[model samples]
Target chain A: MKNEIKIFSPATVANVACGFDVLGFCLDTIGDEMVIRKTEENGIKITKIEGYDLPFEAEKNVAGVSALAMYNALQPDCGFEIEIYKKIKPGSGIGSSSASAAGSVFGMNELLGKPLNNTELTNFAMKGEALASKCEHADNLAPAIFGGFTLVKSACPLKVLELPTPPDLFATLIHPQIEVKTSESRAILPKEIPLENAITQWANVGSLVHGLHTSDYNLIKESLTDVVIEPYRKQLIPHFDDVKSAVLEAGALGCAISGSGPSIFALSKSEATAKAVQLSMQNAYSKSNIQFETYVSKINTQGIKTL
Target chain B: MKNEIKIFSPATVANVACGFDVLGFCLDTIGDEMVIRKTEENGIKITKIEGYDLPFEAEKNVAGVSALAMYNALQPDCGFEIEIYKKIKPGSGIGSSSASAAGSVFGMNELLGKPLNNTELTNFAMKGEALASKCEHADNLAPAIFGGFTLVKSACPLKVLELPTPPDLFATLIHPQIEVKTSESRAILPKEIPLENAITQWANVGSLVHGLHTSDYNLIKESLTDVVIEPYRKQLIPHFDDVKSAVLEAGALGCAISGSGPSIFALSKSEATAKAVQLSMQNAYSKSNIQFETYVSKINTQGIKTL
Candidate 1:
C-alpha cells in the first residue's frame, strides 16, 4: 500500500455577498500544498513549513492540529508527519487557515487509506480553523474540501451542502496588503439586525443560489446585494463604495469583501470581464497607496485532491 | 380578441419553513377562480362573489383591486368586471387573499391579450395584497401567479424568479379552523432578530433552495428547519410542537407553520408519505378538539392557468 500522499487544498471565498456566514466557493488558483508520509513516531508531527509564519507544535499549528485531529479520530496503527508549503497568506480573509487545515486533513485521509468521508474529513479540518479563529465555521473549510460552491447549512451538527456552479462563471480576487482579523471583523457587527434587512438578505441569498443553478447572470447580479453585514464592514476597507461601483461599472456581476475583509472579490460572466473588473478595482485602490495582488480564476471544481 | 377570460390561481404556501418573506410555492388543490370580462363602464367592478364575504367596491376588495390595478396599468379602452369564486379561506395562511388578487389580475391579463408578463402580473397582484394587508409583499402573490417554487428576489423593482421543484416532492397542508390575521401575526414578531438566528435562518434558506434544485431529500430535511419566525408564531397555533413532531415521525421531510400561521404544512418524498403526514398532523390537533381541513397535493407546476 502507498504510505505517503501529496494534496492541494484551494483558497476559498466565504460569505459570497448576501450569504454571510453560510456560503463559500473555491478558487482555482492560490492554495496550500501538503505532503504526508507514514512514520514510526508516536503521534502527528509537523516536520517542515515554508513561506509563512505559523506555529510548529503539532497542537498549535493549523496543519499539525488538523492532522492530529484526523490521526486521533482514526487511531491508525502508524503515525504520520506532514510538511506544508503554504502559498495562501495568513489573515488575507481568503481562507488561508482553511487551506492549511483542509490540506492537512485531506492529505492525512488519503495516506490513511481514505477511511473518512468528505463530511467527516471536513469536520476534522474544521478543528484546525477553530483553533485559529476561536470559532468553528465551515464556510471556508467546506469549499476547500468539496470545491465549487458550498453552503454551511448548520454549524452545530456540521451539515455542508455543495451547490452547483455555472460553467461561464469566473471570479476576480484583489488581496490588499492589509490585515483584518476575522474575530475583530465579526465582533464589530451588530448582535441584532433589523428583521426587514434580514428578509432582504435572505431573498438575495435565495436568488443567488437560484442563479448559480440556472446560470442566470442577471439573477446573480440582482442577488449579490448585501444589506446587513456589508453596511457595517465596509467602514474597515478603503474606498469600499468607490471600488464596488468601479467593478460594477466595469461589467462585474457583483463585488463584495471576501470572507471578513482586506480582500475584495467580484464575480463575472466572462474571464475577460473578470480581468477588466480586476483592473477597475485595482485602479480604484491606487489612490490609497496600498499594495495589492490580483488573481482571476475559474472556480475550482475539484477541491482538495491528491496529486 | 376574446373579451372574457376565466382563470384559476393556485393557493400558495409562503415562507416555506426557513424562507420567510422570500420563498413560496403553489398548491394544486386549493385556489380561487375568477372570470374577467371587458366592460363598457369607465372603471372596474366586482359584479359577483361566492363562498366568502368580500367587498363589492372596485377599489376595496382583493379581486376588485387586483382587476382595477391591471385595468389601470393597461389603460385598455375598456374597463373590466370580475366575478370571484373564492375557495381558499381567508386568514388560513394559505395565500387566501393572494389567490383572489392573482386570479383577477391573471384573468384580466388574458382578457387584455396578455399584455403583462408573469412578473408584471405579479406586481399588479401584489397591489391587491398590499391593499388588504397594508404592505406590498410578493411572497404569496409571486408563487400564486407564477407556479411551482418562486423567489421574490426584490420587492422594490419587483424581481421574481421561478425556481425548480423536485418532481417526487409532495406537500400536505392541514389548516385548523382558526383565525390568525396576517397583519396581527406579523405585528407580533419582533422588529429585530438576533444576528445569530438570522444567519442560521438564511443558511437554511440557501440549503432549501439547493435541495429543491438537486432533489436531495436529506438536504431538504436538513434545510427545512426554522429559527427566526416559527418560534414566535407557533404560539398562535395550538399543539404546534406536537403536530410538527408527529408529521416528522410520519415520514415528512420537513414541517412548519404554512405562511403566517394556523395552517401547518409538511413536505414528503412521496404522495403516500404526504397523505400520512397530513393525517398525523390532523390527529395531533384532534386532541385539542379543534376542527381542521387537510389537503395533499403535488406542487402545482402550472400556476394561474385557464380552466
Candidate 2:
C-alpha cells in the first residue's frame, strides 16, 4: 500500500429540489485537492493550508477532524498528516466543508489499503461535517464519497444509495459571493408543512428518482420541482426567481438553489444547453451588485479521485 | 375497427406504503371483466350489471360515466353499451371502483380505434373516479390503466408514468369485510404534518421509486415505510399492526393499506413468498370477528387486456 496519497474531492449539490435533505449529486469541475501522508507519529497534524485562511490546528480543521475520526477507529499504527488546498469557498453553499471532510477519509482509506466502504467513510466524514454545520447529514458527503447521484435514505445507519446518472446530464452553477448560513436557512423554514404540499413534494421526488433511473429527460424536467422548502428558502438568495426563470426560459431542464443558499445550480441535457444556461444565469444575476462566479460541469461519476 | 370488445381490467393496490396517493401497482389474479359494444344510439347505456348491485343507469354508473366522458369529448358518431361483471368487492380498498372507471375508457378507446393515449384515458377515468370517491385523483386508475407500477406525477394534467416492473415481484392482499369510506379515511389525515416527518416520508417515496427501478429488494424493504399517512389510516384497519408484523416476519418486503383501507396489502419478491405472506396475513387476521378474503398475485404487466 502506498504511504502517501493525494485525491481530488469534488463539491456537491445537496437538497436537490424535490429531494430536500435526501438527495445530492457530485460536480466534476470544482473541487479541492488534498494530500494525506502516513507519518511515524500517532497524532493527526494539519501540515499546510492554501488558497484560504482555514485553521491550522488539527482538531479545528475539517480534514484533520475527519482523518482523526477514521484514524481513532482503526488505530492505524502511524499518524496521518493532511494538506488541504481549498478551492471551493466555504459559504458558497456548494459543500466546501463536505469536500474537505470527505477528502481526508477517502485518501486515508486509500493509504491504509482501503479498509472502509463508502457508507463507513460517509459516517466518519459526517462527524466532521457536523462540526462545521451543526448537523450530521450525509446528503453532501455521500455523493462526494460515493460518486454520481446519491440518496441518503436513512441517517440513523447512514444508508446512502448510489443512483445511476444519465450520460447527457450537465450542471451549470452560479455562486454569488454572499453568506447564507445553513443554520439560518434552516431556521427560516416552518416547523410544519401542509400535507397537500407534502404529497406534491413526495410525488415530485418519486418521479425524479424514476427519471434518473430510466434516463428520461422530460420526466426529469417535470419532476425537478419543490413545493415545500424552495418556496420559503428562495427569499434568502438574490434574484432566485429571475435566475430560475432565465435558466428555464433558456431551455435548461431545471434550476434550484445549490445546498442551502447563495449558490444556484441548473441541470441541462447537453453541454451547449449548460453553457446557454450559464449565460442566462449571468444575465439574470448580473443585475444584482453581488459578485458571482459561474461554472459548467458534467455529472461526476467518480466522486473522489486520485491525482 | 372492432364493433365490440371483451376485456379484463385488473384491480390495483394504490398508495403503496410510503407513496400515499402517488404510487400503485396492478395485480394479476384479481380484476373485473367488461364487455363493451358500439350501439346505434346517441348516448352511453349500461346494458347489464352482474355480480354486484350497481346502478344500471348510464349517468350513475362508473363505467357509463367514464365512457360518456370519452364519448362526449370524441363525439365518435356512435354510442357505447357496457356490461359489467364485477369480481372485486366495493369498499375493499383494492380499487374496485377504479377498475370499473378505467375499464370503460380503456375498452372504449380500443373500440374507437385507440384515439386516446393512456394519459388521456386516465383523465376520462378520473371523471368517473371523482364520482365514486368525491376526489379527482388517478392513484388507482393510472395503474389499472397502464399496468405494473405507476406514479401519478400530476393530477390536474393527469400525468401517469409507467414505471418498470421487476418480473419476480408479487403481492399478498387481505380484504376484510368492513367498510372504510374513502372520504372518511382521508378525513382522518392531519392537514398539517411535521416538516421532519414529511421529510422522512418523501425520502421513503424517493427511495422506493429507486428500488423499483433498480430491482433492489433490500432497498424496497427499507423504503416501504410510511411516516405520514399509515399511522392514522391503520386505525381503520382491523389487526393492521398484527398483519404487518406477520407479513414482515414471513419475509415480505413491506405491508400497508391497499388504498384507503380495510384491505391491507403486502409486497413480496416472489410468488412463493407472496403465498407465504398470504397465509401469514390469514393467520394474523383470523382472530378478528370479520369475514375476510386473501389472495396472492404477481404484478400484472398489461393493463386492460382483450379477451
For candidate 2, report its TM-score.
0.98
* Regions more than 4 Å wrong, model 1: none
Interface RMSD for each predicted structure:
0.7, 0.7
Chain B of candidate 2 achieves a TM-score of: 0.98
Per-prediction count of colliding residue pairs?
A: 0, 0
Estimate the lDDT of model 1: 0.88
Q: Which ten residues in a row have the lowest lDDT in candidate 2 chain B?
A: B157-166
In model 2 chain A, which range of ten residues has the least summed lDDT? A58-67
**Runs with alpha carbons beyond 4 Å of true place in candidate 2:** none
lDDT of 1 by residue, A111-149 (tens): 777888889988988899999899888999999999999
* Model 2: pairs clashing at backbone N, Cα or C within 3 Å: none
For all predicted structures, in order, the TM-scores are: 0.96, 0.98
lDDT string, candidate 2, B106-167, tens digits: 98899888988899999999999888998898999989988999999899887888888878
TM-score of the second chain, each candidate in turn, equals 0.97, 0.98
